[model samples]
Target: MDTVPETRIGWTFLTNHARVLTAIADNPSVRIRDIAAHCRLTERAVQKIITDLEEDGYLSHIREGRANTYRIVPGKVLRHPAEAGLTVGSLLSLLVQDESERSPQYAHVKQ
Candidate 1:
């Protein structure tokens, strides 16, 4: 009997943090549940990531009734020495796609 090779998943180029941030950039008014679903992460994970971003001054939120409206702090610098001078806005521009330009897989994802 021939044994089939098991394909192992490797590290992704982007971290879960970047994924969550990109999701938020796509929709500032998006909900935490929505972000979790879109990023394939737990709500708790998303909440923690959001808190971390806020504490570092990379992100902020304004309470609007039952929902939170997030705002990415503009002109904030990236952390890594290799990515010196890179801004969150620039990173999002590379990762985020306009609603009309997104592929079919992301069509169901809210903007």
Candidate 2:
């Protein structure tokens, strides 16, 4: 009998920064705890990443009562030379696709 892998490999195409950014883009009012949960990172780690992004001019946030509402700088250019001229808006558009919003039903589909 064959078994499925329960854990992911050590690496992926996107970095933790990208994942954190993606998570925030998914929900502007998302909590740090929620972002940590989604990104498989510790709350401290997420907080540090948020700081880095803010320092680099990629993101910002404002306190709304007890919660924080994030604001992404969509016009900021990406870091890599290869992605030169590409805006944060473009990256978020690709990562936050409509398909991701739909509940997946792949279990019912045959391989």
Candidate 3:
């Protein structure tokens, strides 16, 4: 009997920074361990990404007991030249679907 070997899939183009940002956007007060699990990265890597984002003014964190509460700066301009003058709000608008047309889980979360 022959058994199939497990294959590991690696990320292609998406950066760790992007993954961290998306994770934070989804849950403002998500734990670092949760972020690592969601992003398939190590805790140290997630911590580095969080530090980078904070230093770049993309995110601001408030220490709330043991958990850090994160706030995104939606007005910050994107760094790419092609995206010049575009703010985080504009980018999120493009990504977000119409709430009324979404599934119950998505709709419930918004409310």
Candidate 4:
């Protein structure tokens, strides 16, 4: 039996933090397991990222029964000095994939 190696790309446009946040934005009640799967990270990694985001005041969640409903602070400015005045909303807008990108023939033209 042969095992396929992981596609370890050097880097991506968005950080894991950003990816996790976007997944939460898409579905507030999403499970950490799903976010991990979407971000290609482990469940433990996703949990840590959520803790970091919450500690930094970018994210907050409410426990509703057995699920958590996440709330993103849209007005929260980015951490980097270069991204001054850029809000969380701005970052998430760019990360969200469009309908065209889902097409089989759509080549992801690097921006």
Please report, in order, the local distance difference test score of every candidate based on alpha carbons. 0.82, 0.81, 0.71, 0.80
Give the alpha carbon lDDT tens digit for every residue of 9-105 in model 4: 6976778998899878767778888778667899999999999999999999999887899999999999999999999998888865665553321
- Best candidate per lDDT, number? 1
Per-model TM-score versus the true fold: 0.82, 0.81, 0.72, 0.79
Q: Rank the candidates by lDDT, best first.
A: 1, 2, 4, 3
RMSD per model, one decimal: 6.7, 7.3, 7.2, 7.8
Candidate 1 per-residue lDDT, tens place, 17-103, comes to: 998998788778788887787767899999999999999999999998878889998689999999999999899989988777755
Q: What are the per-residue Cα lDDT tens digits for candidate 2 across 19-51?
A: 899878767778888677667789999999999
Arrange candidates, best TM-score first: 1, 2, 4, 3
- Candidate 2 is scored at a TM of 0.81
Report clash pairs, candidate 2.
Answer: none
> By TM-score, how accurate is candidate 4?
0.79
Q: Please write out the lDDT profile of model 3 over residues 1-111, one tens digit for every residue.
A: 012225348745546776678667666788888778666689999999999989999999999877888888999998789989998767756543455553332122221
For residue 14, give model 4's deviation from the true position in Å. 1.1
Name the better of 3 and 4 by TM-score. 4
Model 2, runs deviating above 4 Å = 1-6, 99-111
